[model samples]
Structures are given as structure tokens and as C-alpha cells.
Target: MVTGGTGVSGETAETGAGGGEALATLHRVFGYDAFRGEQEAIIEHVVAGGDALVLMPTGGGKSLCYQIPALVRPGTGVVVSPLIALMQDQVDALRALGVRAGFINSTLDFDERRTVEAEFLAGELDLLYLAPERLRVEATLDLLSRGKISLFAIDEAHCVSQWGHDFRPDYLALSLLGERWPDVPRIALTATATRATHEEITHRLNLPDARHFVASFDRPNIQYRIVPKADPRKQLLAFLRDEHAGDAGIVYCLSRNSVERTAEFLNTNGVRAVPYHAGLDGSVRADHQSRFLREEGLVVVATIAFGMGIDKPDVRFVAHLDLPKSIEGYYQETGRAGRDGLPSTAWMAYGLNDVVQQRKLIQSGEGDEAFRRRAGAHLDSMLALCETVRCRRGQLLAYFGQEPPAEGCGNCDTCLSTPETWDGTVAAQKVLSTVVRLQRERGQKFGAVQIVDILLGKRTAKVIQFDHDQLSVFGIGADLTEADWRGVIRQLLAQSLLAVEGEYGTLVLTEASGTVLRREREVPLRKEPKRPTASRSGSSGSGSGRGGKSKAPAVELPAHLVPAFEALRAWRAEQAKEQGVPAYVIFHDATLREIVTQSPATVRDLGTISGVGEKKLATYGEGVLAALHARTPPSGPAPEESPESPENPESPQSPESDWPEPPDEPGPEDWD
Candidate 1:
């Protein structure tokens, strides 16, 4: 089982000794001079054969926690991933770093699987990736038994938790791993998990003794905004044009039809977009995913089925056309944007219909009473997040059990343009009175529209047919606009004072409605603005109105360096095309930007740049130098060495080096 071979290229034979060696490996292999928060601690612990349960935010350099340990340890590290579709990209990225990584998934042909299996078994792989379902196969277990695994990494560990937003049944079988390989340390990692879900993952993964590391959940780079829905397609188009023109983004919809329609609408309106959903043909879905990953500035309008393990780093925004069922789901989806630590937006177009639709789905969903209750609780939390008048970031972090600063996170919509809260007790009474009159007096149930129409004294045919205009509550709500009445109803539902029932989504009063009707409880609601606020750039020059910090300005190449950046990008694109890999697999945009800014003349100078490890330096250094030279003027001073360039032209730090360190304690904001 321990037979040895030279192993794949970039294989490190030295066993993990201590932090010194780990740092060396980081610099030599990953080309990073420093580790981010808790990265050093996690790596050291895992390398020392300690189990860990890491709750890092997305883009928190989680892969490095297990990867460095794997490289430093003697044998190969076996990673169990749930994203079969993204396994190739994962492996490709590692391979680009000159690491001996391979993946065995359904995407591979028989011969390809066999080759990877042989490499893993022969101790020729530094890392072996397997989809969780692959473990269900006895042959996979047998093969793993024939290999020397230094450690076991369970990626996306939250999938094992049944309460998790994105649960995968196959992850339940992963607990068997600890029993089978008693000596190998195991680390489970996820980008999002609440305390309950965290406990579930620990219990389900059989890692009760594992060291738990819960990083702060704030994604400061992402400016969260929940806008009022009004012709969502047009609003989305306007947002794209106004703030994120030609930027790559994701638009998540609740249904496949919405995904397709949104994609079509974006395309028709001049934004290049593609549709992705489970309903599409397998090949079509794969093709669309591939295109989204490879092509720049192409938006993918998708259902929840997409974006689980997508590693594309330049996504500028994550817009939601429909409400996500829970904060965890919303966080996970929105976390997809700004993975590069640049300013991005988490924009959602929410309206009363979204609340009604979500409630109706829950009521009609196939679940037991307990399940429905849990789903309802989840919806309540999401609705609360949407409705909160305080800092959005604080509420979001609080949901995950982390304390945020007393002041607002000025980056969110609420912090940027705070909405006023008004006493809506009379408005609440009128709406509840209407529902009560319909149910008790007329023995009728009507959806929000009809109720609103009746309350506003509109003699629409349906209202007139039902003689609803004669009701006492009729015309009482005429003081408020139709939009204003809908906001009240939506908030009432959110507060559980109102309940949604039946396929038609008729609104009904809950037991608590009595308190509001009798004036025993006060109702405060966010007042609907006369005009919806136009979507703003999360990275714009405008500061938060409440004095909360805005996100850092977006990273832009200087005009003088733009040519060099573009040329390098063109070269990277061609290389990616020829190699049949995503462009980032060759060199990240950050690295290329640095290359343009520094204008490294020799391969040695290029080697000083972060992300330019030994293998990459050897493979692409000459090409990079050529690209820079081509863009440089022949007669004048080198632009990079010119006075306008950076003063300290020394080797640049990793792109993330400038990123603010996450607060040492639990309360401050952190970038994902």
C-alpha cells in the first residue's frame, strides 16, 4: 500500500516539521510571503495531525489550510468534494501551481479515472479529489486503502448537515472515513454555517473532537442591497448598466423558468448572458457552466442548482431576482461575488409578491408539520433580513452568531441610504380588519391584490362582484398608495401577524393579529419611499450616509499599464484555450496586473511576484517578459520604472496583502 514512485511534478517529499517548513512551502509552492488570518494556525494544526472543523468565509484561502499541510506531510491528501462539476477546475488550478493533483469523478472517462486512480494508489499524487458519491463505490474504498493518505479533507462540510441550505446525502457516508483511517487527520471546511448547522456538521461528520475554528462571516467587500422590486428585468438591466457594465456576475432565480427568462431578457437588452438550471440537458448545462467560467463578462442566470463550488474569482455582483429561502442560502449565493476581495454587490429585487410566493411554496411544499415549521422559521429570518431598518451587515453577522460593531456597516443599502421607520399601527389595523372581515363576515378568502383593491375603494370587477366595496374597512387605507399597503401586508406576514394559505396564496390573520387589532401591540414598519432608490455601486466614490466605511475602491490598472495588462490577458486567454482550461488556471488577473505594474525584465524578477511559484515561473516567465516588452516603448524610459509608477518597485505582495486583516476578535467585519 505504501509503494513509492517519483510521484507527479511538484511533489514535496519532506514531512511536516513545524511552522518554519510550512512557511517555506507557502513561499516556494504558492509564492505567497504571508498567510491570512488563522491560516497559519489551521495549517500547523492539521500538519501536526489534528482534526479541524473550519467555518471560513468564501475566498478566505481555505484550500491553503489543507493544501499546505498535504504538501508538507509525506503521503497524498485525499479530498472529498461534493462539486463533481468543478473537480476538473480544482485539479487544473493545483496542477498549474505545479502540485501533483488529480480528480476522479463521473466526468472522466474510464481510462481517465483509471489513470488518476493508479496515480493515487502509487503514491504519485499530492492531492486526490473525489466526489462524495464516489465513496459509495467499494472500488474507491479499496483503492484508497491501497494508498497512503496523509490527511483527509472534507470540503463543503456543511453539506453533511441535513439542516444546511445545500445538503448532500452522500456526505453522510463520509464519517466512515475517520473510522477507516484512524491515523489520518481529517479537516471539514465550509464557507457558511449557522450554530445549529455547525453542530449538525460536527455530529454528522463524527468530528466531535475536532478543533472548531469559526471565522467571522462578514463579507465587507460585498455591498448588500435589497431593492424594491419594480419591473425586475428592467431594474436588473439598469443596475447592470449603471454600476457593473461588462462585469461578470450571477443572477439567482428561484425557478428554472425564471432563470431562462432572466437570461433571455438580459441578452435581449444587450448584456451577454447564458441560462443554467437543472432542467437543462446535462450537456447543455455543462456547456453553459464551461462558458460562464471561461468567457469574461458573461452573466449566468441560474437556479440554486448552479454555483455550489464555482471558483471563478472575478464575479462582480450576485443579483437575486427572487428571494432565497434562508440567510444561509443567500449568503452562500451572494458570497460567490467579489471572491477576489474587490468591491462587489449583493443586489436583490424584493417585493410583496416575493414574500407571498415564498410563503405559498412553503405551505404547499411536501413536508411534515415540523419540516414546514422549520422552513417557515427560515423564511422569517430571511424576511427579517430584507425588512431590517438597521445596518444590514450587523443583522447578517448576528444571524450567524457573530457580533458586529455597534455602528452600521456603511456599505449596505440601509447604511448607504437609510430608510425611515414609521408607526404603522393604524395601517396594520386596517389591513388586519379587512382580512378579518373577509374570513369572518363573508366567509371568503382573498389574496393581497384583491384585499388591497377593496381597501383602496377600487371598484374592480372582482371586488364589485363580491360587493367588497361596502365593507367597513373599504376606503380606510385610501390614504396610503397601493405600494404602501402592500408593504404593510408584507411586513405583517414577515412578523407572523398574517398567514398565507392555499395555492392562491390568500392572506389570513394569525392569532397574534388580535393584539394588533386591539391596540395592544405597536406596529413599526419601514416606510416605502416615494421613489425607489436607484442601485448604487458598492465601490463608488460616494460614502455611506451614516459614516460607516464604504468598500475600498475597485482595483483598476493605470492607463499607462492598461496595454500591458490587456496583452497579458490576451496571452492568457489563448493559453487557456489551447490548454482547454479556464483563464485563471494560467495566471490570475491579480498576478497579471502586478506583472504589468512591475514590468519584471528577467524571469528572476518575475519569480519575486506572488503566485509565481517555481513551476509557474519556469513555465510562463519568458512569455510574460515578452508580453511586457512588446507593450513597452523602445526609446523612452520603461513606464514601470518611470516616476509615475509605484515608488517602491520592490516585489509586490500577494493581491490580498493589502486586504484588511479580519478582526482578531469575533465582532468586526471581514472580507470573504
Candidate 2:
């Protein structure tokens, strides 16, 4: 590793792990006074030249792991990204903060690529971001051997694993990053990953010794909703029209064609809509993405390509057209919204075959048999999520190895709907007994659908072939709907009461399930409501807060300050125009509410609100305070003012004029 000559802080250095001096540089350079979650831990490790793999949430601040260290460390940090958009987005944000950041991807021409490479050679860059495909170039690897690169960060590192939904061949080349730069610390970061995926990432990146910093997967800010995929289009329209009206949101579809159709359909309706997917021309895609990011109230109907690196924080909702392949994909997509920590929603629709079709696709794919099997299991888990009557957030978090200890989150559909559950003691016993009887005779060999059919006394071909229909437990339980029965068996497997024997394992009674077979005790089976397929637009399209109409138009300020508020509102509009950003972005309703409540009369007084930091207060305080001081005379009927001036109280020379007039009038009256 090269010892520092000049650092990203614009200062010369000669040390190793730059210590508190580097941290000071970070705070100054990044404008953040403190770190969030395990940022401090991961930063410390990478700063000390140790490898790390951070699994943080969408807004968990993963970029700082490499960013802060890049400025303080001895060499440029090389971030391996999969998308050109991701590199450019981060580069733009960093440059805004006055950091020397640039990226090279397929989007650049040969000349542009050459220019950035020249800067890399001259050590003129702080953070150098690259597509993993770019790193595969012979010249690129050769340059890495020569240049002073201290950190190799693989963003969206989950792509490296076959287990992840967004698997890419280029990402597998990440192992070369560590192999090529053995001494430098390599940190892999992703917003979503299961335990299995974490292992695959570790092995593929060759960072087995890396520290794993796993943040809580909970997006308590995001309200999770799973509407049945009945009339999804109408439901989506109704949802947008009713709840998140005039706000930026996404409607995700499974196919590029679906994306376009959805976007057009939305446009035909009242919403401002645009379509985005890989099939669109690059420029069109870029323009659409740019509009969605930079402007508010533009809805983008898209596939997975639309949201990998979106940093726009105020996305009001994320609606899915078809089901996502796995819960991980779903969470990450929905997690894109509500990153600003204001309330948002994750809404999706799915039908029965949506699950079957995805499962069929995975099984039919030509990959490692093990990989296909894993995909099937993942699909099952996702199906479980779609069919689950429990807290959707809880199920999602649990899938990622986090436990939710609440009776209900109260924010998800299941909690709000309160699915009635009852003693499955007898039902579970019957199901387990059937599994046991079948296993005792043949083995744990069949899928849940097959097994459920056998227990419900359906004399199908497979059951007849195995003589399972003749079993005593057969026909003992058929009261539940296919969906309901499937849910119970799924829960049993999830709770470790049953196990699949094959790749994902079919239902075989586990030791716990065996207890139910022996009539040891009752098992709780949730009796989900007989809900009609909730049309996509059929959801309770309430505001992000509890229920009913949003407290949005808060009883228009105080009557006394209403005119002052109007003046402030006009000033806000003017400022918004000058800045060329949305008025809400410049100052949210929360900030306006503060201004109305405080009615500060001076710049300093306006700056007293917590939201008005020094920089903003300096820039906007005077105008805002001036508006507040420009009071209106109040309202009922307009006040009429007297024409008299309030200055002089005495009538001017009235007596003198009267005497002069009387002398002329007296002479005339005497003649008459």
C-alpha cells in the first residue's frame, strides 16, 4: 500500500490508519457530525485496514464506510458497482459536498473513460467508482496493481450470490478485487441479504475474515400492505388517486412490456406517469429517471431496473403489479420508499399462479441444481409472505434473521385486519398424523399441495398410487380452503414442526410436529379472514398516519396570524421559484407548521426552530421573518379607515376664517 502523499482532505499525510485526525476530516468533509448504527464500527475496521461486509438498510448510510475512509486513508477507494446510474448518482452527491468524486462505466465514451483513467493515474481523485465489468479489463486490473488504492467496496454485493434475486456474472469477478489487492481492506455492502446470501457473498468476495455489521431490517416508517391481486390495475389507480395523490411514487411490474402498459394506463387515468425498464432506449431511460428523481409528483411505472440506486427520500409509495420472486427483493424495493423516515407505504398484489409461475421459472432454469432448489424455497417463503395473514413486516424481518417480539406491528395489513386464529390442536394433529402415516409407510417424499390433498381425502392419482386415500387419517380434515390449509402447513414448516425432504424439502413431521401427531397439545392455526381478492385499488387508501383524512390542511394557522401566514406562503412560493426545486423540498409542511406556530418577528427568532439550522437560517431567515412581521389587519369585513390624518388635533384657524367671512357677509347683508 502506498503511504499518503496528499489525502482526500486536501492535506499531505505520511501515516497509516489516520485516527481521530481522519475522523475530523470526515465530519468536516461530509457535513455530518455523527455516525449512524455500526458505521463507526465498520469505519474503524476499514480504517485499520481490515475487511468488512455491511448488511444495512436502505437509508443506513453504507456509503460512509468507504467514503469517510477514502478521504482519510492513503489511497483512492475503488467501489465496484453494477449500474452506471448508481455510480453517477453517488458521484454527483459527493461532488456537491465538495469532494473530488468521479465514476467510469459503460455509459462513458472511450475519450471520457480515458480522461478519468488519467486522473486516477495522477492521484487526483478521492473516490473512484467503477462498474464491475470495467474492472475485468486487462488495463484496469494492471492499473490497480500500480495505483494506490486502499479500499475495494462492492456495492449491492448481494448480486454476487446465486441466492440473491439480482445475480450478475460481473459481480462474481469481485473475488478478484481481494485477490488482486490482498493487503487492502475490501468491504461489501448491500441493503438486503438472507443468511444464506451472506455466506455466498463472503465466499465469493473472499472476505471470510471480514466483520459482519447487520443492521435491523425493520422499516417501521414503511407501512406494509398486501392487497390481493384482484383488479390490480384499478386498485393501483384508486390507491394513487385516493391516498398518495400528487406525490411521487412507483408502480412496479414484472415485465418491461407490463411497465409500459401500466405507465400508459396510469397516464390515461388522472396520474402523471412515465415508463422505465431496460428495453427503453438509454436516453429515454435516463430522462425518465432524471424526472422522477429531480421532480415531485411524477410516477414511474417500471421493472426492477428503476430503483437500484434511487436516493430521492420522499417517495410516497411503492406498488407492485405482480409478485416479486422473493421477500428480499420485495423488501428492498419497498424499502426504497420512506427512506426519509416520514410515513410511506409498501403495497403489492398477487394471485395464486403468480407464485406458481415464478416457481416454475426457477425450476426450469439451467443452473446449479442446488441453486434452483434454493430458488424454489425462496419462492415458497415469498409465497408465504403473499399468503401470510400475520404481520407482513414481521414475516419479512424474520426471513432476514431478525426477530420481531411484538404481538403485532399494528402498521401492517394483518395486524390492522386482525386475522382470527384458533386452536389447531385437532387440525394440526390430523395433518401431522397423516404426514407420519405416509412417512412410516414410504418416506417424507411429497409436496404440501399433494400432502394436503391426501389428508383432505381427495383421491387423486398420486394418492391412489400410494394407497394414501385408504389411510385412516384421510378425509379427517377438509373444512379449510386450499389457501387456508396451505397456510397452516407453511406455518408448520416455518415453525420447524415439519420439514421438506428434497432440495427445499417436502413436509415431513419434525420432532415438534411429531408431538402434535401424538396428541401432546394444541397448535395455534391462524384463521385468516374470508377476504375477497382485494382489488389493487380496493385497499383502505387512508393517509400514512393512522386513518381518515390526513391532518394535512391543519386548521389554517391562527386567525390573528392568518394574513401573516399568507404573506409567508407567498414568500415561500417565490423562494421555491428562485431555487427551481419543489416548495415542499425547500420546506416541508412541518417547517411551515413551525413557522405558523412560532410567528417569529426577527431573523434570529425565526432561526430558533430546530429545523432552521444555521446555513438555512442565514439564507432564508430574513425573508421569512419579514413576512411574519408584515401582519394583516385581520378579517371579518374589511376595516374602513377614516380620511382624517392622525397628526394635528386642532382645526386650522377656523375662528380667523369665520371672522373674515363675517365682515364681508355683514357688509353685503346690510346693503340687502
Candidate 3:
């Protein structure tokens, strides 16, 4: 247990080499001043030749826990990552910081692979990233054997758990790393994990002695809201236009077709969006991913295949068009937003169909009975989170084994506008009684639509065809609207009082249904909010405070400084294009905001601001100073429009070419 590291200060004992060097490296390379959470301790331990397991939230500076130790230690650090598509960008980001980083992945040609390998052996690289699959090859293992390894950093460590949301079979072989190199220290890190998943990772990776560090799983900057789904595409559009206009985000769908449709709808309605699924050509996916990273305000409509290791720090929102399978998957997906610690949103459109479809999928899935049971348990937890009347954030944290605030987190939809829960016992009985009549009298089972229609006293064709008007339960629920009836059925499904069976998602009664009908169980259900009307006030039924327009700072910028900030962004965009890197790679928006506010006149002065590390200070400092000078506000009234503002025709947001059309059919990877 290496210790002696203080807060953000660089002061430390010589014995704990990482305490001082880690802080120095952070400032010199990444441009941050202090260590966040357990970063200092984790780095110090790894630097002193000890193993560690780190579980921190996204955007919690997980990279530095290993990167700093790698730089401070004697030999190059080898990183085992699961994202082959993102390895290059990861390496590029590191290189932008003036760190010698390389990756050996399928994207590299033979010559390129040999070159990286030579660099590794010659001690010319500080960090080398490899896909977990790469380590399976004999040549790759032989190459590592000849090199002096500083440490092994296993990223996305939750993948080792077979039951984890994003499990990878290749990760199972990672356990061999400890056996092959017993003397070398290792660090395994993941952004999302429950206690069970954490234990599985430890046991799978043979990290019995590794020190465990579990940071709080709460992301206060992200406001979580699950609205009842109406027209999900339109709901998503309203969300984007009202609260997150012109902001970059991700929209997750459960099907490839939905991804395509949503992207097209957003494009036609004036939101720039692109589709990404495994069915698309690999190059197309790569191109789309690159554009998203480089362009501002671009939204990627995708399935789960995207956004595993995305490092974009400025994503303002992550919207789900469908229900995710588990709480772990939901947390991991939503955590992608607000990586920069700026206020962001985790919004979802949940409805009866989502519940029915998810249940159907679980039953029809390829897994055995045990796998289905595990999957069912996962879905149950996610449903509980969606139907929760308490703080959404609190429910999420509790699922991860963290004790949330007793009163509730005030930022989520429930906390912001407390939902009213009514005595739904009667409503539950009504729905259960209707199901019983259908099955017992008619010897028929139908989906939510048929059940809802029958209860609402609607003389639809199916009801009349069955001569169901004679049924005693018919029209008994006429007091409730169709939407209300559907809501009741959805809640019943969530509570396990009702069950979905067969391919068509027919509603059936579970064993618990008997208690509801017997009046022995009291069903309390959240009263669904009325359908939201369109509003431009930046407020809607989802909740208040939509984080405002894109490119806007967390705190409003002074009118006088807005032009300078816009100019800096334009300059940064040009630099990113010229260098083929993300704009944040050059300098984060937070760093640029500070530069504009401070109006640093010289390169040396710019270094004083956070995120202006030594390498960036030397490479882009003069250019940044020049941009600030060019956009100096005139003594008279400010110009009508800055270059990046919406009013400007030449603004990046105005170009349709920035968002390309996705292929008609995406690949058949994993469908909901």
C-alpha cells in the first residue's frame, strides 16, 4: 500500500515517486492542477510496483491513473483495450499531449505493426495500446516477452464478467497476463460495475492482491429524466431544440431500422444527425465516428455498438429511444454524456411498447433458461428504475451498491417536479380482471393494444369479431382514456402483476396477479404526466433547466467575451482539421473559456490557466493569443453576429454536407 500523496499539490516523499511526479506529469501533459478523487493514491501505488483495481465514473480522469504511472515508471505501459475502432484516436489524443503513444491493432499494415513493435522494444514509446484479441496471437505475446514492460493496464475491465452488459469473450484470456508476468504490476479499470461484476472481474483477472478503489457512482452534472413515450422521434427533437439546441449528443436505439429512421427524421427536421450500426460498411462507421468527434453539434443515432470508449468530453445529452436491457447498460450509456463535468442530460422516452418489446426479446433470446433468468432479473431492475417515483439518480446509485442521499437528489425529473403516486390498486385489479376474462371466458390472449381497447369500451373490429361486448369486464374501464389504460398495463407489467408471452407480446397474468385480483396487494402507480406541448422557453414536461443552447458555457459568458470565445473555437476547429484530431484534443472548451475570460496577452501568461499544459502552451499558445486579439470587441456596439453563431450563414452548423446520409441498411450486429 503505497501512500504519502497529498491533494493536488506536487509535494511528496522521494520514496513514493508517483506522488510528486504524477502531479507534475498531470500539469505538464494534461494541464490539470489537482488529482481528482483517488487518482493520486492509485497512481502512487502502481508506480511503486503494486497492482490496483479502479472503478470510477466516466470523465473521472480514469486514463491518468495509469498514464501518469506509465510515464513515471521505468518501462513503457501496455494497455489492453477492447475498442479497436477507437485505438487510433486514443493514441492521437496522447500524441497531442506530446506523449509517445502507439497502438497495434488490425488497422495497422504489416509495416506499421512492425514499426510500432520496434518502438516498443527500443523503449521509444511511453504507452502501447492493444486490443484484447491481439494478445491472443502468438506473435503478439512473443513481442511482449522481448520488451521491458512497465505495467499492464486493463481498460474496460468489466468486460471480463460474463454477465456484464458489454462482455467480451476475449477478455477471459486476460487472466493469463498475471501468470505470464507475475512480477509486473497491473491495473484494471472500468467506468460501470456492481459489486458482483466487480468481483467477477477480480476473480477472472487473477487480481486477488490488487487494491480496490471504488469512487462514488453519482454524476451530479447529468440530469436524468424518463418521459412517457409518445412520438419518440418528435419527443427527441423537442428535447434537442428546446434544451440542447446545437449541442453534440448521442441517441441510442434498440434496432438498426430505428437508428436509420431517427437519423433521417432529425436531419429533415433541422437537427444534424447520422446513423451508425454494425450493418453499415466498416469504413462508413469509421467516417461517421470521426465526423462526430470533430464536428460541433453533430448527433449520432446508433445502437449499442457505438459509444463504448468514446472520449468526447462535450456531449451535452444522451437520449434513449428505447429501454435498455439492464441498469448497468443504462448507466454506462448515460455516463457518456457530461464527461467534461459540465451540466448535461440523460433523457429517455419509455412507454408500454418498450416494456412489451423488451420482455418479448428476453424470452425469445438465444440464452438458456439460466441466461434468460439472469436477463429477466436485469430487465426487472431497469424497469424498477424507470417506474421509480423517487430520485432517478438515487435509484441508479442504489442499484450500483452506493448509498444515495436520503432526501433524494434534486436534479432528476422526480426530484425537480415530484411525481404524484395514486392508489392504483383498483386500476391494477381492473386490468387483471380483464385479462382473466379474456383467458378464462374467451380462451384467448392478446397484446396490450387489444387488452387496452377491450377495457376502454371501444367497439374495434377485433372486439366485435369476438362478440366480446357480452363479457362482464367490457366497458368497465371506460372511465380511463386509452393512454391511461395503456399506462396501467405498462405499470402492471413493470410490477410483475402482468406478464408478456409469445412472439406477439400477448399480455398474461403472473402468479402475483392473483394477489392483485384478491385485493390483498395494494398497487401504487405513478400518475403519468400529460402529453407535453411544444415550447421554446427551454422547459418541458421532462423537467426544467435543459442546459441551454450549444457552445454556451455552463455559466453564461459575459456579452463582451462571447466574440473572443467564438473566435477561439473557430481557430481551434481549423487546427483540429489541419491535424486530423478532435477539437477537444487541441484544447477543451473549458480551457478555451478560461483563456478568453482571462485575455492572456502572452504565451507564458496562457500557461497559467488550467488545461494549458507545457506541450500545448508551446504548440498552440501563440495561435490562441492571436485569436483572442483578432476578436477583441470594438468600442462601438458588438458586431451583429460572430462567425460561429447561428445567425452567421458561414457557421459550421449551416452546412448540410457536414452530416452525410447513412446507408439504407445497417449491418446485423446485435439487435435489441
Candidate 4:
């Protein structure tokens, strides 16, 4: 047994429990029979007083790694998190499992905070969740000094990396945890961290000695699709109507106004939706988030501000109305869907403007040269993903330094149906030639639209004023529509065959473009797929079709069992409403589906369902059994109450939503 070290004075040093005991507790306390990937090893390491760095996917059981160790170890487990909204829900969920957990943040009053502090010093808490900012206060540190900490679990550890999309300066101070309490073990966890971000986290958090447990970063159940932005609202509506009509999901926009308008548009069109962003009053944001967690089939149209530390696991899809800045940000944002191991969709509609806006923001930002360069690299990776002709999953996983699965994942848009590509050398030459001509011969720098107008011989005001009509290239692309010309231009930009310069996004020839003009390079472009009309009766494409339906949900209860499933869902919702807790907190949809499928006839039978810990089984088992009984057919033979199936572990729960409130730093626009 590892004895106490420097910080162990006046504190209990309980020997770490054996694996048998840990397994027993898993079934007794949390009602799981087995540990997930690397979980058992992680828990044993931390419980025996070893440090660790965990990089698991969103729905992977991260909390359990820390939570179980806290129970198995001698003292309170302190978790440093970012979001206040997630804190209460997490504490609530843990308490439901009969664990004594508390959190101290802005959400609590002085009296409440003091009480939690007192409980901590007395060694009464199994877990204590705190925001990173709380660690900055001297008094808070002083309070921690008086207690025994089993281990320090840093949630969303990627925030410590400056290059991380959700970077928080306060997280940098976490390095002191190692120095201040040299005896205590620490585990830093994140769902999204690339190779660079991973190294930075280890170095920044003073966790150089910690074991790095990098789980497969694949969320195979979420289908990835990227579409061209054309009437975004209509596209989104058609997406929802076709495939995900009654499903719970999130739509992320790049701006607050877009969030509001999209939410309103969805609601007006009969989709229950809410808008969430930093610009909204804190109370309103909280209310909307609470409603989203509590309601079924609700969609939240939000900025990137919405999802961090949000633990609602049944979100059916995540749709991006605008392009995110980097692949890491996209992965983190899209990982919020299909958390329950159910098939979900990750959909997006990005266009030329998204490219221009993101690039312009990066180029003009106040960051130092290195920072801007890194940002540009990140943006370039995301662009490549949008334009890639190969398997998206392969590209996405390869970005994280992992080999893609041997067989292509058939779940993404590319694998379901390969997108067609066209030889674009002629189109590229025409666009590049025009830029060279306008700059060298005409001495005129023009944007894409003006160049397009000159090519199609539109004789628009700008074209006429520039006398571009007299050029040999004028009307040369008259056969292509305005959109087609624009597509060609954007494709050129994407391929680095052209570049957008300065504040106005004017087209400029890159060194790479010179080859195309000289007929030394061939350019290939993605062919834009035909967009489905509003009046079209079917889904625009595969994955998310009309009625917002995917091929199947995470939970596919038998046809005869769906009525019982609905009954149990209704009962859970009612219980949640009465208790003012999110329905998932009472019992996740997965658990209910298990109960419905098993047709549990009594409390004993209900207790066999996954997610039914001893405490929860005692509290809600009777209610769940009754709900099942109400829907059981009269002629059906009642199965005897079966033995408790301890191995039926539910989909890993994610009470930690990671939408860190936009940090106090400069907003995205500040850079540009």
C-alpha cells in the first residue's frame, strides 16, 4: 500500500482497495459489472496513488475513471471544471448514485459555499467539483490545504493549451497542483486534443510523469456530412423535417444573431427550438439549457458557447450552420452527438464566405506571428477536411495521429456515397488567367464576384467601370452560371491555386497558381451535388432524410416494446418535471429502453437494467416497474422477476457538457 506523503499530515491514508473490491463497488454503487476501455487500469492507477492523463472520446466514461477512484481512495476527489451549468447536474447525478458530491461555484451562495467547504475539510465529500477560477482565490487554496485530497482530476485539460480552441489562462495555473501537493496524484482528461495539444497539456499541467492513456478518438456512430451553404435555414429545416424531426440535437452557428434567427425559424416551422449564446442574459441561457436537457425532441440553435460540460447524452445530431475554425473545434463540437452509442448525425453547411471570414479573422487577429501561423495551419486542416475526396473518418483520425479502421467507416457521407470530382484544370486556368490579366494588363484588383461577372460577360457596373469586358478572357466562361463560376473560384482558393488578400477578400494568384497558368499543373475539384428543393418529398440525401430520421436511433426497442418505451419515457419526464431535474438525470433514455426491452415486471426485474444502481433501484425501481406494467399487454405471459444482471452496463454517461463560456479574452472578431 502506498503511504501518505508530504500533504498527508493529519489525513487518513487508506490503502487502495483491491480490484475485486472495486468491481464489487462498480456493481453495488454504480450498477456496472465491467469497466470500459482503459477505465479499470486508470482507476487502479489513480486509486493506488499514480498520476494519469486520459484522452477519451466525448461519450467515453471519463467521469467514472475519476469518480470510482475517489470512492476507492482515502480522501475527497477534487475535480476542476469550467462550466457552472454542468456542475449542479453532475453533483445531482452523483448524488443519485448515493455518492456524496458537492460543488462550489458562482451558482452557490456564500452560506452554501461555506457549508461545502466545511464538509470538505471534515472529509465528508467523495467528490468536490470546482471551476478553475476558484483555484485562483487564496482563500479557496487555503481551504483545500486543510483537507485530504485523494487525487486532482482536471477535466477538459486541453483548455490549458494556448493553442486549444477553448483555452483558459486559469488552467495554466494548474501546474501548481503538482508543485504544491507533491504527494497527491493528478489525472488530466479531455475529449479533443491533437498531438500538439496533448504535448502542451502534459508540459503545462506539470504532468510529464503521468501515464498518457489515449483511447481511440473515433465516434463511429455519428455520421459525418458536409454540405454547401445554400439557404441555410431551408436546408436545416429540410434536414430536420426529413430525418431528425422529433430528435434532440444542437445546431451551432458562428454568430449570436444567426443563433437567434435559426432558432426562431425552426420554432415557427413547427420544430421546438431554443437559442443559446454568450450575448443572451445568463439567466436566459441557463433557462434555455435547462429546458433543452429536460425536454424531448428539442433542438438548441447556439453559438460555440453552448455545449461544453453539457452532459445530456441523447442528443441525436449536431449541425453546424457555419464552418468552425479548426478540426479540433469541429470534433469537440460534433462529438456532442450520439453520446449514447446510438447512431447520430454530424451535419454542416459551409461556403466561400465561411472560408473568407475564418481566414480574415485569423490573419487580422492580434496574436503574435507564431500564434497566427498556427491558427492558419489549423484553419487549413479544416478546409482540407471540407474539400477532401477521401474518407473523412480516415482524415479526421489521421489528424490525431491514429490509424483509421481497416474497413472504411460506412457511416460518413463519403463512404455512404462517394462525392463526384471533376477535372478542373480549364476552370482553374481561366480564373488564374483573369487574376493575372486584371493585375498585370488592366492594373485592376477584383474580388471573386467581379471576376465572375467579367468571365460570364454580365457587363455589371464594376466590370464596365474596369473595362474588363474588352479583355480576351471576358465572356469566356459565359457557358457557366454565376454559381458555377463562384464554385470554380472557391475550389481554386481551397486548392491553393488562388488566395484571398487584404481586407476585401480580393483574389490573388499564389505561387502555386502560377503552375496552372503555365499549364504545368492539373487541378481537380469536388463536384457540387444537386440541392433538394423545398418542395422535394424525400430527404435531401442519406443519413438525415425527411422527418429528420436516421436509419436507426441509439435505442431500437422492439416494435411491440415501443409503446412501453414511450410510457416509461413519459413517466420519466413526469418524474423529472415534479423533481425539477432533467429527465436523463432521473433515468437516461437508454436505461428506459433496456427496461422496456426486458419487460421488467417487478422492482427486482427493473433492478436488472443497466444504470440501475442500488440507490436508484431503491428510489425509482418501483415507479419504473409500474410504468412497464401499465403498458404490458393483458394476454402477454408475465415473465418471472429475473436475477439481477450486473454486467448490463449502460452507455457511458456524460454529465460534463464542455461549452466553456467564451473566456474573457478577445472574441473571434477581435483578431480580424
Question: Which is the leading candidate under lDDT?
Answer: 3
Clash pairs detected, candidate 3: 279-666, 279-667, 280-667
Q: Flag the better candidate by lDDT, 3 or 4.
A: 3
What local lDDT does model 2 show for residue 639?
38
Better of 1 and 4 by lDDT: 1
Ranking by TM-score: 3, 4, 1, 2
TM-score of each: 0.89, 0.69, 0.91, 0.90
lDDT of each: 0.80, 0.67, 0.82, 0.78
Q: In candidate 1, how many Å is residue 594 off? A: 2.7
Q: Which one wins by TM-score: 1 or 3?
A: 3
Worst-scoring 10-residue span by lDDT in model 1 = 1-10
How does residue 153 of candidate 2 score in lDDT? 84
Could you tell me the lDDT of residue 177 within candidate 3? 95
Candidate 2 stretches greater than 4 Å from native: 1-19, 22-26, 363-365, 422-672
The digit string of per-residue lDDT tens for model 4 on 1-672 reads 111100101000112233676767776776655666677788888888899999988877777788888888899999999977878878877787789999999889889998999999999999999999999999988999999999999999999988776889999999989999999999999998888888999999998889989988888768899877767777788878777768899999877767777889999999999999888888998899988877888899998888987788788889998789899999999998866666688998777777766666777767899998898888889999998878899899999999986777777888878989998899889888889899999787877778888888888887777788899899999777776777787777777777778777788888888788789988988887775555444445444332424433436544455678788888988988897777777776666666665676677776666667788889888888888889877646543433532234333333221011221233555221
Give candidate 4's TM-score.
0.90
lDDT of 1 at 478: 83
In terms of lDDT, the poorest run of 10 residues in model 3 is 651-660
The digit string of per-residue lDDT tens for model 1 on 1-672 reads 000001111111211233588888887877766666677889889999999999988867778888889999999999998888788878888887789999988888999988998898788999999889989999999999988999999999989987665789999999999999988999999999888888999999999899999877877878898877767787778777767777889998877766777889899988999999777888999999999888988999988889888888778889998889999899999998876655688888888888887898788766799988899999999999999989999999999999985999878888878889999999999999999999999999999889889889999999889999889888888899988988899899999999999977899889999999999999999988664454454222222221212321124555466677788888989989999988877776666767776677889998877667787888888988888889865645545545544455333333234001111221111101
- Count of steric clashes across candidates, in order: 0, 6, 3, 25
Best by TM-score: 3
